[model samples]
Target: MGCSKKKIKYELSKEFQFEAAHRLIKNYSGKCINYHGHMWRVIITLHGHELDEKDMLIDFNELKPLKKWIDKYLDHTTIIWENDPMLTFFKKNNQKYFITKKSPTSEHIGEIILDKAIELFDNQRIKVKYIEVKESNTSSVKVYSNKY
Candidate 1:
């Protein structure tokens, strides 16, 4: 006999935005080498095979941790390289900054967010599918996991 309970494949997403400053080092040279700030936007998507008792794949409020993570790491902060000279100026002024192991480009940031999502929600049936980081209205990068 077929199962009486209804089955649903669910997908949910949340959006977040924060302001941050960064300069790319140990890479290409361009305007990005100059300190700049962007009202960065991120979209996090989660997919699940089963819903919780509340019939929800994930509550919007429960996703707050992701936002908190971004705010703590990237918001209003300067992103720099491991031993870039800019680190001295940023520190002297006591600026909030993240010294990324790799370049802090939007593409890399997308991967960072994706990793954070996997770490943040692995216990839940809701699995992170992708993370999109937008530096501007016209430019963005997406990182996703197909295995989920």
Candidate 2:
């Protein structure tokens, strides 16, 4: 009988911060419901087994596109729920913002990032392990993918 084999894996992480604004748009008891901004921090982790001809699980340079995408969409922009009426006003005022179906809380933002990351990395040949989002140094959340 042949023995099963285990493959070694390599992981790569990229972390960055961006400024954005959001309001809970809910009947909650906190400042999240009011307009505010944060220097949000995000970390992206990728896992892979096989390396390309370049002997790398993934080329770090390939992450430039992700950085550009984040800067274009999330940096210094307001994030809002799709159903939030503020979205219409912001659009009409020609402001930059990202609309999501989920609430823009720190934890939910982590979920949103993970959801988009799967599609964003479809052609990268690497599986996303998790995404960690931090609203502040003392507050953070991580969303893991089942494939991880």
Candidate 3:
């Protein structure tokens, strides 16, 4: 007889957007001097250890709320690097916001996004084994389990 239960691994990713401004110090942008926002994209990956009765590792619907969290907080918010002098000025402006101790590169932002996604799976046994962040469609960085 075939085994009724199977242990299957499943992974799913969701994309979200945020708007924020940042400047790279000593970088070559003559007029990056002014604040600018990006149509930032965040991709969150979720992993699951066991398959349910449907032989599914995870239900896509279950991961939807993670997008909601990102949209409400990080979306359309100015993300300031911890060391930037602009931090104080943005605070003074009292605009929508978020703060980062590191430069707001896609990798750093990816970690923040990954951390939040994992929180949703807290009661589950599965882990977010990996994360990949893209600053532009052509460029990206990843963090893996070994780094954890």
Candidate 4:
């Protein structure tokens, strides 16, 4: 007789890209202190043990709204830490900007995206697993959800 175990896990992922600018405000940094922009790439993963009536983890179309939200708010916008002094300048000039409570580093950005995904999709059957944010081709950060 052979022992066998049941399969009980599934995962799905989605990728999105946006162009944005940010600066490290309070931390000791180098050239990044100056305003700069990058083509940001984000990947979100979702995990679940149960499938829906359609026999799928979740329809990829369900994630389109998340991409739409990012394109509307973060694309081509300067992301600024709420406490940065330059915020006043951007506000005065009426420039497009997004404010974040924490410094807008790649790691925190991943966390922010993860939080958004959880808010949009998390439920009793499915949950967000992690988010990977790539600020450059060779540099990236993966932030995991604390809920799981």
Q: What clash count does candidate 3 reach?
A: 0
Residue-level lDDT tens digits of model 3 in 15-107: 666666666543435565456767776666656666667766567777777778777777778776777787788789887778887767666
Q: lDDT (0-100) at residue 144 of candidate 2? A: 95
What Cα-based lDDT does every candidate model obtain? Answer: 0.85, 0.83, 0.68, 0.91
For model 3 the TM-score comes to 0.76
Q: Report the number of the highest-TM-score candidate.
A: 4
Q: How many backbone clashes does candidate 2 have?
A: 0
Question: Which pairs clash inside model 3?
Answer: none
lDDT of 4 by residue, 46-140 (tens): 99988899989899999998899899889999999999999999999999999999999998888788888899999998999999999999999
**At residue 76, what lDDT does model 4 achieve?**
96
Task: Put down candidate 1 lDDT per residue, 33-129, tens digits, no spaces.
Answer: 8888999999999988787889888899999999999998888888787778888988999888888778888887888789988989866577888
- Candidate 3 weakest ten by summed lDDT: 24-33
In model 3, state the lDDT of residue 66: 75
> In terms of lDDT, which candidate is strongest?
4
Report the Cα lDDT for residue 113, model 1. Answer: 85
Q: For each candidate, give its TM-score against the true structure.
A: 0.89, 0.85, 0.76, 0.92
C-alpha RMSD for every candidate: 2.4, 3.3, 3.4, 2.3
